[model samples]
Target: MCTETALRRENGDRFCLSTAQAETLLTGAPWRRFLVIGDEVADGRGEPAEGYGHDGWADRVAASLRRIQPGLAYLNLGRKGRLAAEIRSRQLGRVLEFKPDLTALTCCGAELVRDPFDADSVEAEFDRVVAPLRDSGGDVLLVNWFDITRFSPRSSEETERLRIRLRELAERKQAVALRHGAIYVNLAEHPAAADRDVFGADGSAPTMRGHAIAAASVIQGLGAHLTGAGDACR
Candidate 1:
C-alpha cells in the first residue's frame, strides 16, 4: 500500500511517493512537539533557482497544523545538503540531547550521490542516528527523502539505480523507526507545491512573499500532526 504511486519525470523516468502517501504516514501517529530534521529543503532553504526560500515541506506541514491551534511550536533541524550519515554524525547526537516529543529526520539524495555503490552505509548510519532517539522518551519520525532526481535531466541508468537505492533507503529508514516504535513521514509523494512561474526572473531565491507562503505550508502540516488541528491558510 505504501508503494502505490510512481513519480513520473519529464524524461519518462518514474519514481514513487505522493501527498496522500505522506499524509498516510502521519495519520495514525501520536505526535507532539515536532522537530523536523532533513536537508535544506526540509529546512526551508530553497536555492536561488527555486524562487522560494528553503522551508520546503516542513513549512507547509507546520502551517497546516497552526490553522487550528495558533499556539504550537516546532523545532526545525534541517541543514543544507545534509546526507544521511553526515546528519547521523553531526545532528543526531544533539537532537537526542533535546528530548523532543516527536522528531522527524528527512534524508536521502545526498547519500545516494555520495556512495552510489554502497547502500548499506546509509542504512547503518540511519540506524546509528535513530538509535538514541528510540532510547530516549521520544517518538522518532523518519521523513523519507523526496524526489530530487526528477529535478535534473540526466536520466541515465546510473540515475535510475540511484532512485531505486533511495527508495530502498526510505524503506530501511521506516523499518528502523518502526522497530523502535516511531512514526515515519514520507514526502516523496507530495505534489509540486510550486508552480512553474513561482520563481523570480533570475530563478535563484524565492521572493520574500513566496517564502512566507512556503513556510506557511510546512507549518500547517506540522501543526496538524503536533496538535490535532485543521488546515491553515494556503
Candidate 2:
C-alpha cells in the first residue's frame, strides 16, 4: 500500500497522501497506470527556438510519477494540433486499449483555431471522447484547455474574445467531467501559472517550457489527489 505524506498549498492548508492513497481510491484497487492525451501542449511540439522539446507535458508528468513512485508506468498520447473532434476520432481506440488507471485530456487553443465558433460541435466531440473512458470503468481526469490568445499583443483583443469562447468550452467540459465523477482541472483558470509565452519564436506552436509547466502542474495536482493531501495544490 502507498503511504500518505503531509503537503502544504500556497493558500494555506495541510493535506497528505501517497501513491498508496491513489491506489486506494481507484476502482479496481490496482497499481497506477496513467495515460495522458493532449494536443501540442501535451506533446511539446514546438519549433527550434523554444527551449522545451520532445519532453512535453507527458514527460513532465512521467518524471514526477517516477519521483513519487519509482515503478509507476505512464503513456503519453499527445498529438500536435489535435482538435477535440480529431482526438475523438483517432486516439480513443488506443486509449481504451491501454486500460489506464487514470487518464487526463487537454486541448483548447487548437480547437479555437480548428473549430472556431462551433460550440455545439466542440461539446459533442468532448462527449464522444470521454464517454467510452467512463464506460470502461477507468478513472478519467479532464484538464481544461489552456488559452494563449490574451498573451498575444497584436491579437490580444480578438484573442480575449476567443478566450471567452474557450473558457465557455472549458466550463462545459468540466461539467461533463463532474457529471461523471471524473477529476477535473481547469488549467485555463490557473492565472498564477499561465503560459505567458504560449507560442514559440516562430509563432507556430506551444513552447517546450509551456508544455513542461502545464504537464507538471497536472502531475503535481494528480499526485496530490492520489496522495490525498493536495501535494501539488498550486
> What C-alpha lDDT values do all the predictions have?
0.54, 0.61
lDDT of 2 by residue, 100-138 (tens): 777788776666755447877877888887778888787
Q: What are the models' TM-scores? A: 0.61, 0.72
Q: Candidate 1 — which residues are off by over 4 angstroms?
A: 1-32, 47-55, 63-73, 189-234
Clashes of 1: 39
**Candidate 1 lDDT, tens digit per residue, 3-107?**
213312211211222334334434544444667777764686543432223335566555444433355467788887787777877787667766676676776
Clash pairs for candidate 2: 2-20, 15-229, 16-229, 17-227, 18-227, 52-208, 224-231
